[model samples]
Target: MLAKARQSLRAACDQLNIHPDVYEELKWPRETLAATLLIRMDDGSRRAFKAWRCRYNDRRGPTKGGIRFHPNVSLDEIETLAFWMTFKCAVANLPFGGGKGGVCVNTKELSQTELERLSRAYIEAFAPFVGPDRDILAPDMYTNGIVIAWMADEYSSITGQASPSALTGKPLAFGGTVGRVDATARGGYHALRHLEKSLEIDPDNSKVAIQGFGNVGYHCAKLLHADGYTIVGISDSSGGIYDEKGFDPLAVMQHKHETGSVQGAKGHGKTRNITNAELLELDCDVLVPAALERQITLENCDRIKARVILELANGPVAPTADRKLTEEGHIIIPDILANSGGVTVSHLEWVQNRSGYYWDASEVADHLKKTMERETQAIWALHNEMSLSMREAAYIHGLRRIAESVEARGTQAYFDGA
Candidate 1:
């Protein structure tokens, strides 16, 4: 993942004519932290879990990212994720940098009590490293608002005061924003909406295949469906469901909730249960890979049938696939820009927490729509001007801002003498 991320940055840097020093700095993280978390399990035996946090770049402002809990978590993955967040924040025009944290554990195996203890234990170990003015952690995979609230509570307990601003993605009773749950998808929807006209996609007739049926994928598919787009394919970790005619996303969700996965969701006459990879290659007008990283690569890039790809997952398309997809004339809305809605609203939650004021969901949505549209336009404009791929344009847009910030500080390199 880190290699692919650096490769993407290098591609952008090559076009930007960036200084070697700046390019090197952008390729590596500022700090990567690892912790051994000892937590007492329900069985009363203490277990050690591997935890990691990476602050990639703070040239823009205090770093912000999500804390994930998964069995596959690793320092390398977290570091690369943080690197993407650094660019993701800047691409969205947010006044924050990038940070990421995660713990290695099978969250499905833990009870609620054990989960709470683990979440709080994570904060207790990293309290000094996180704050509103420092690295702020939100919810990611296998983590949610309650987990965020637990971490925030732990941070407050450690500091002897309320620290709502120390984190975002908490339950509304704590400090989470109204539109946050759907913000990631909504933001991608708004950004993707702008490309519809230029890409000549008619939502009323176009087919969209979503690779992940999680929060971001589910919401994006739902929103696109509501906006008159035909959602012909949707998938979860277990498998996917496909039909030539559109399927009701919410109904599929309901079926999945009743069963164990969407694979059981009954499809119409031309229905089939497909693997995650097969879902990506479905013949559709738009493909939204809201799943994990490296879904699109050179191995499968040639099989991608979608005219437009909305990346709601970080690093969904490998750097090698970028050139392949581009050569095939596919338009990709990079994850940094496409899935930035979550962090954008995270900033909103921070604002409301600091000011002790909250906006209605509509107000938040309006601001988000406008913000994503504006930022999307900037990258789109750049892509047109330079004939660069969407991902490269996004990196350049972010790198330029970060370069200005680094130069303004003038606390490091003296080559430019800013």
Candidate 2:
């Protein structure tokens, strides 16, 4: 996955005629640390879990990304996510680079106490590698506010200083900024809203199908539905639910909360259960893959019917599949540009943390709206001007920023008397 992502970067570099030093610096992770976190289980036994952290690049500033806990978490995945984060921050013009961390474990299998021990142990292992001005960690898959609180508290304990800035996505009382809970979804929302007219999408008539029912996906559906879009399909890890006449996001969410899945949720019209794969092929105006990576790959890419794809998850659309979809006239709102709201708000949290001043909810929303619209518009302009796919254009936009920063310190041409 990292190699594939690098190919895209290489292509962008070639298109931009960027300094070779820029590609050299961005091709590989600057540093990656791996550790075995051993913890005591509830059954009086010890178990070991593999963990990794990759600071992909810090050319812009300190690295920032999330720590995910999942059975499928791998070093390659972390590095790739970090690489994406590097571009994501640059795309949003955040004063940070890219970094990511993960543990190979299923949170559902662990007791709360065991989870706490594992979280602290992770902090203990990577204490030397992370800081406010270094690599900041946020919550990702299978991790949430309580988990972030544990990690943040452990970092404080290890450093003997309250360093809330070391982590984002914390509880409000713990110095987390407002508007961050839905920032990722809201960022995509802002981008889509900005492009509605350009994409010829009418919220009153268009249908939306979301592949993930998590925080980001739910908020995305809720926001779009509120704006008069008909949500035709919704899915979670368990399964999916579809309706032709659309469903109310709040009603589906209430059902999901009560039943632990969206499979049986009721909609405005006929609601039926479907597989996650089927949700991707549903005829809709917008398809939002908010769940996992590589969901719309070569096999399923051909069957995708949505005219536009809003990627709220990192690497949800594979590179080859992205090309096919774009060639097929699908307007893909690339993940770097679409789902950068989380990191943008995280940057704001970092700023608020450093200044010891917190913005109100409205202020945070306003900032996010402005940043999302500005970046989205810039990327859209590049897409049209360069006749490139939105993904390619976004990469060029971010790559320009990163390459400029890299060349500012002087490239080989400067050293060679160009």
RMSD of each candidate? 1.6, 0.8
How many steric overlaps are in each model, in order?
0, 0
Question: Which window of 10 residues has the lowest lDDT sum in candidate 1?
Answer: 409-418
> Best candidate per lDDT, number?
2
Give candidate 1 misplaced runs (Cα > 4 Å). Answer: 411-418
- The TM-scores of all predictions, comma-separated, are 0.97, 0.99
Instruction: List candidate 2 stretches off by more than 4 Å.
Output: none
Candidate 1 lDDT score at position 185: 94
How would you encode candidate 2's per-residue C-alpha lDDT over 36-63 as one tens digit per residue? Answer: 9999999999999999999999999999
Per-residue lDDT over 1-418 for candidate 1, one digit per residue giving the tens place of the 0 to 100 score:
7876788788777888776667777888998888999989999999999998888988888999999999988888999999999999998888899999999999888999999999999998888888999898999998998999989999999999998988999999897889999999998999999888888988898999999998899999889999999888999889898998878888899998999799867655577888888999999999999988889988999999998999999878887887889888999999889999999999999999999989999999999999999999999999999998898899999988887787665534574454
Cα lDDT for residue 150, model 1? 89
